[model samples]
Target: MKLKQITEVRYITRDWDRSTVKRVVKKLTNGKFVRKNSGPNTFYYNVPDIEYALDNLNVQFGEPATKGHYRTSQGDAAYYIWVVSGWKFKLSAMDMKLEVWPSGDISDKHNHFRDRYDR
Candidate 1:
């Protein structure tokens, strides 16, 4: 994907600033983690390489944590691993829930429920 698209996705998914995304992208390129492709209009980055770079970076540097009701990079990584392992997490008013299924589904329905129930 293009740098801008990747940056935007990272911003939305990980709450990373544009500068951080740019810096990470630069690091991936410099370190040869991602194969950069130049097109006529924009530069494209390899998706798997980006994922690998991010996973490695998260592991090496550790994800920053925050207080209540916010998603951190560590949380995102955990969720990613959970989904890949065919599991799902749900936080309820009374307890935290986890489910394992053959087909992993990651949706915002749980978030919606949590938001509505929390308040």
Candidate 2:
């Protein structure tokens, strides 16, 4: 999607990490850069097609903490593997997006990103 498509944005006006929030917005909006506006002190970005993202990706909340979280062990195992496999993640009210790497490199960045939001 084009970068300027992100139109609607929402955020809590408490103390938050600026760069991390922007990164999440950019990812959710398909890499579009987010800018701040003054009128009421809001930080917003563009999503070329929010419907497409909402419709296409398999958005999910907290990982299945246990086997009960998944319908089957296979699913749970897969989820566990994916979580530990070092994918950069950003979670929103919508779903979680993993910044997958070409070589499948899982690193501390994933945890750092997760820690920023999963308080």
Candidate 3:
């Protein structure tokens, strides 16, 4: 994908400004989320790498450190951000249950909608 395409998609889905999108894209690039391929008149991004980086960043930064079910509007916003950032889950609302595990045991039993949602 190109930078313009990514910025446009994020703007539509997340209502982010172009500058904000550009900043985040820069961060992602610095974090090695996407590789830059500059051509004579165009630049392309590695889509798969970007997806992986988004997922990791969502998990590492979006997930609340606190435990338990989240039902507030703020929680919903965070959840939406996670989804927008490439979290692959099916949730209808922010009332979805969540679990937190400080330990390194992240299993299916600790699903995103369960008691082990955050790490």
Candidate 4:
């Protein structure tokens, strides 16, 4: 829970580490960079459903440093980025568009992204 400025407490995942968060965020470069494509170009969902995804992100990773967030239409997607530990966290919302690095060990994340955001 957020405490006084002198002593704020944040509940994070068991494996959560600031360095890990930074590392992962850096891999994306930013919200628009992807290395390899694995899923369909885009998946359309209701706005509330996508919003639930956003809420679930907060529950999973604590709150991120909310950055630019804008939604156009249901099918017309836009990024809702967040900065955590000085890194741009692009995968917070399922609306995220990511390209996985073929040589990296982040295939699981890619799969999770596809599963959650896929129709």
Candidate 5:
């Protein structure tokens, strides 16, 4: 599916604690919302399409996103800047705009959807 067409996707937030990561996975991959199987831990939720979307997005926008650091650095500095350069993106659902945050966290505020929707 096109990222722009995913207008009302679920926003799965974790519990903040370490176990929250697991909870967030459950929130995103629960069988109630996806396909069901016999054993609780035996099944897996597969979303190859999401991976495809991310790959396409990175290919389309990754170089442009890293150009800022490329132009600033001459030699060795460029190598250092490359460490975290893969975290940039142009979220199609979030207005098809460039977003550059230190952490790779995508919050509702970053998408400008705070006022329009519940977080």
Candidate 6:
């Protein structure tokens, strides 16, 4: 299937236009790219694509994910920054985005997503 024309990815934000989401999805893999209701409209993507994101995001992706050091990089299209919020976060490739704060484990790296959608 063409990644650019995905329907599985669901966004609850107003700024996430169809073309914008499609453009971002085209660059990502593993199928589900979710947009949050708050926090700069960060487009939460797949962690499996972390390597591709890190290598291509113009920064070290895995290091921050495992070591818990926040990292970010500028993207080319439909996105502003590609991020691996290494700060007290964890990997979450759920069938649906978790609406609750699962835990207060600061060391858990509760943030693990790839980009901030361009607005």
List TM-score per model, in order. Answer: 0.22, 0.29, 0.23, 0.29, 0.17, 0.26
State the lDDT at 37 in candidate 1. 46
Give lDDT tens digits, candidate 2, residues 1-119: 43332222223333234454454445554634343331222343344654544332323213422222334543431121112122223213222232222223335555566678878
Residue-wise lDDT of candidate 5 within 2-116, one digit each (tens)? Answer: 3332211223233133233223333332212133432332222333333453444443333333322223233322211111221322222212122222333355546555556
Clashing residue pairs in candidate 5 are none
User: Which residue pairs collide, candidate 4?
Assistant: 35-99
- Consecutive 10-residue window with the lowest summed lDDT within model 3: 96-105
Off by over 4 Å in 5: 1-22, 26-35, 52-119
Which structure is stronger by TM-score: 2 or 6? 2
lDDT of 5: 0.30
Error of 1 at 77 (Å): 20
CA error at residue 110 for candidate 1, angstroms: 14
Q: Candidate 3: global Cα-lDDT?
A: 0.35
Residue-by-residue lDDT tens digits, candidate 4, 8-119? 1133423334444433433222233232432232212223344544554455446644444455665444455443322333432445443222222244555666678776
Residue 83 lDDT in candidate 3:
30
* lDDT score, candidate 4, position 28: 25
Per-candidate RMSD, Å: 15.4, 13.9, 16.5, 14.6, 14.8, 15.2
lDDT of 3 at 20: 48
lDDT of 2 at 114: 63
Ranking by TM-score: 4, 2, 6, 3, 1, 5
lDDT of 6 by residue, 1-119 (tens): 21232233333323344355435444543335445442343344444554343333233222332322233363221222322221222332222221111222233233333223322
Error of 5 at 62 (Å): 18
